[model samples]
Target: MRHTWRWFGPVDKVSVREAAQAGAQGIVSSLHHVPTGTAWTTEEVEKRQQEVRAGGLEWELVESIPVSESIKTMSGDWKAHIAAWQQSLRVLAKAGISTVCYNFMPVLDWTRTDLRWETPIGARAMRFDLIDFVAFDLHMLQRPNARAEFSAAVIEQADARFRAMSDEKKAALSRNIGAGLPGSSDGYSIGELTEALGRYAAIDAGRLRKNLIHFLSEVVPVAEELGMRLCAHGDDPPWPLLGLPRILSTEADYLEVLRGVDSMANGVTFCTGSLGVRPDNDLPAMLRRLAPKIHFFHLRNVRREEERMPCSFFEAEHLEGNTDMVAVIAAIVAEEKRRKAEGRSDHQIFMRPDHGQEILEDITRGAQPGYPAIGRLKGLAELRGIERTLSHASYGLA
Candidate 1:
């Protein structure tokens, strides 16, 4: 696997130089300033490339070219957005970037209730507390029919949780849940969220899946012609949220999309942290089965707070979470060997330490939540160590 780091460009708290120092051989980034539905110009693409090159690293993949809400719903300007997306791909391919990662989750990119949940070891990690999320949806955003979505027990728990919070806490919780992640264009105010949710009133999982397939049908061919890989990231938390359908949450969902498009360019970005949120998504087994279509890896772990669906979870230490990191890494190494024996040029997958706990000087730096420099460095070191051990000739695992 090629080690890569996600950089949010020039304004990011962590610099590209720091990424290089953290031992990243390449970068996974996007032109975030380019608004959704707009085509990226070659000048903008080359500007970022020059920045990454100056740091002595290559821009290996685009973390995303944001899929606009218009395209997702097939609504106003949807066709135009598709054309713009195709244009962006042409520009990227011209600039020599071959892999692009994107997600189709509507309304929000990735939702989290707490950006600084304290861990037992005195580090800060991101968390998704189901009760807190329910409370926000019920009392804060007040989405219609939200009560029907939760079980009676969960509703009761959420009611109590909501009542116990002070006004400041309530506001913070709202901001954390509604505001989007660091490089995402989908952040929303409560009013904005309500309006967005209304647009999806008629679209369920099946329709959303069809929309995704339609999207792939339009864009995947361009990617294939460009010798580029378009990998769809699994839905974060791997479930529905805010009354919106999540079409890419399970193995079945991935199979549907892959089979729907039926091309090597139409692939999945095997994100263990997102898919692992569900108890049934056997990471190693899934990796082996989807080896051919898996194009990128986000190797982070989560410790589920409960066994039930819609359960709470926190980002745990890389090797300390519920995931069997060793088994997953071994599978990755084995797949690389198989690809080598097959003489495939796109054999080595690009991976990054997804979200790391905030620790050490990271506590004071106020780095992007879940993207603390030292914490990710710690994760990359551990992951690299495991890959080396598995690939060692004595182990015969590679």
Candidate 2:
């Protein structure tokens, strides 16, 4: 696997040179300044490429070209947005970039209730506390039918939790959940969130799935023609949130997507942390089954607080969470061998240390949440060690 690091363009606190210094061979980036629904110009693509090249690293993949809300909902100006997306892909291919990753989660991107939950070792990691989320949903956002979504026991717990919070904590919780992540297109105020939720009133899981298929059916051919791979990222929590449908959460969901598109150009971005949040997902088995269609990997892990649905989880160390990191890497190594034996061109996959805790100098640096420098470097070193050991011992690869 090619080691890559995600870098937000010029504005990011973590520079491209820093990513290179941390041992990343490539940079995963996007034209974040380009607004959603706008076609990317060749100049912009080349400019970002130049920035990455200046750091002595290549821009390997586009972390995302934000899928516009119109395209996801198939609402106002949806066709135009699709055209722009295709245009962006063409521009990227013209610039010598082949792999792209995007997601279809409604309203928000990857979210967490706490951005700096201090671990026992004094490192700060992101966390998603179920009780806190429920409290926000019921008392803060006050979405209709929100109470019905939770069990009576959970509702009681949420009420108590909400009551115990001071006004400052309440505001912080709302900001953490409603405000979008680093590269997300836009964040929502409370009223804006409610309005966005209303747009999806008629769209359920089935309808959303169809919309995604329609998108792939339209865009996958363009990608195929250009010999580019378009990988859909899995939902962050791997479950529905704010009553929105989460279609790309499980193995069955991915199978349905692959079947729906039925093209190598349409693929999956295998993210261990996201999918591993669900206990039933057998990571190694799923990797083996979907190896042929997986074009990108986010190798991270999370520790689940409970065994039940809607349970809370915190980002754990790469090898310390519920996921069997050794087994997962072994499966990947085996898949690479199979692809090589088959004489396939895309034999080596692109992977990154998805997220890391804030440790050491990371605490004072104020790097993007879950994207600290030393933290990710530590993760990359650990992952590289595992991959090398597995390749030499089991797969017999140099």
Candidate 3:
């Protein structure tokens, strides 16, 4: 595994030098300033590559090249958007940036009900509360079908949660849910967000899955030709929110997409925190089964409030969460070993110690929600230690 750190850009609070010093060999980032549906030009790609090299780090993966809403719903200039995405891949491949990550989550990228949920030790971590989310969906956003999506018990809890919140709390809740795309500073107002959700009202889970398969059918061929690995990130909470169906949340979901595309280039990002949120996921098992096609990995843990879907969760310490971190890492190392034996050039799968607890100076550094410096450096150190110990022990030489 190649140790990678996510850097937003030159404007990022955590500079490339800081990431390199933190022991990251590669950078996971994207052209955040670029708008959705636009092809990333050769000049732009090379410019960012130069910046990474200057900071003594290789740009291993573009965490995303945003997939447009038009592409998701197959509406309003989606063909042009698809063409632009293909062209962007061509340009990126020409620039020698072959590994990329993107997600198919509708409206908001990853919803966190609280950005600074206080931990026992006084540190903060991102938390997703089910009741808060339901409150936002049913009472705040006032979606027409919100009641149908949940049980009366769940609805009652949400109603009670909504009723207890102050006006200030309600506004903060709105802003948090409307917290738009990852990496982008832009967000939406309640009105704008409600309208965005409305666009998907006619599109159900089956249609959404078809849209994803169709998308892969169009783009995976381009990725294969370009020698690129196009990885789809799993849904953050791994459940439907605001009536939007999450098609990429489970192992079955991935198998369907990979088989639909039928190419090595169509791959998975293998995010533990996201997939592990669901108790049924079985992280180590999923990694072992899907290892060959997992091009990138987001190694983090989440403390689940329960074993059910739509349960509340908070980002936990790398080794302290419900996820068996040691086993997950072992599976990854095993896959790397297999790939190396097979003479694969891309044997080293890039992984980042994702979503560390906001501890130490990170508390006031105002770093990106989950991308704090000191905390991630700490995580990388812990993960590196595990890899070293495991690697040494696995060699049965006398």
Return the TM-score for each candidate structure.
0.99, 0.98, 0.97
Stretches > 4 Å off in candidate 2: 393-398
Question: What's the lDDT of the predicted structure labeled candidate 1?
Answer: 0.92
Global lDDT scores for all candidate models: 0.92, 0.91, 0.90
Q: Write the per-residue lDDT of candidate 1 for residues 1-398, one digit (tens) a residue.
A: 99999998887788889999998999999998988899999999999999988888999999899898999999999999999999999999999899999999887877899999998889999999999999999999998899998899999999999999999988888888887646754577888889999999999999999999999999999999999999999998788898899988888899999999999999989998999999989999999999988899999999999998999999999999989999999999999999989998988999999999999999989888889899999999999999999999999976
RMSD of 3: 1.5
- Candidate 2 clash pair list: none
lDDT of 1 at 372: 88
What is the number of backbone collisions in each predicted candidate, taken in the order shown? 0, 0, 0
- All candidates: CA RMSD in angstroms? 0.9, 1.1, 1.5
Stretches of candidate 3 off by over 4 Å are: 393-398
Arrange candidates by TM-score, highest first: which order? 1, 2, 3
Model 3 error, position 229 (Å): 1.1
Error of 2 at 224 (Å): 0.5
Clashing pairs in 3: none
Of the candidates shown, which would achieve the greatest lDDT relative to the real structure?
1
